[model samples]
Target: MPDRRDLDIGELMTAFDAVVRANASLMTQLSSRAGVHDTALRALVLVSDTGYSTPTEVAGFLGLTSG
Candidate 1:
């Protein structure tokens, strides 16, 4: 483990920025190619929470479908 006291705020901020940038790049790829997969994943989460719902509900939550 690293020493928490040794962590500089500037270094932590830089690391956070790098992580956000990496995630943006990854989301761009998913949006460009497997966008529907992203919608499906969100729908899965909603179904898991509410037990069951129509495809329209899932799509609506993901901003892809309407009832």
Candidate 2:
């Protein structure tokens, strides 16, 4: 984990948001080439990062409908 003592919470969130945006942009391009939806790639990334995930968690992360 990154050392949080030297960074402000807001600054960290801003940085994380920026990184997520950049990654999303990249995922869009890659998904287009690979013939997959960007959301699929994003969900896979979220699951991969956490090592394990549930349907509810993935749905929430991807803003997918649970119904």
TM-score of each: 0.43, 0.60
Clashing pairs in 1: none
| Candidate 1 lDDT (Cα, 0 to 1) | 0.73
Question: Which window of ten consecutive residues has the lowest lDDT sum in model 1?
Answer: 34-43
Q: List lDDT for all candidates, in order.
A: 0.73, 0.88
5-58 in candidate 2: lDDT tens per residue? 656887988999999899879999999998989899878889999999998999
The C-alpha stretches of model 1 lying farther than 4 A from their native spots are 1-7, 36-67
> Residue 12 of candidate 1: its Cα lDDT?
86
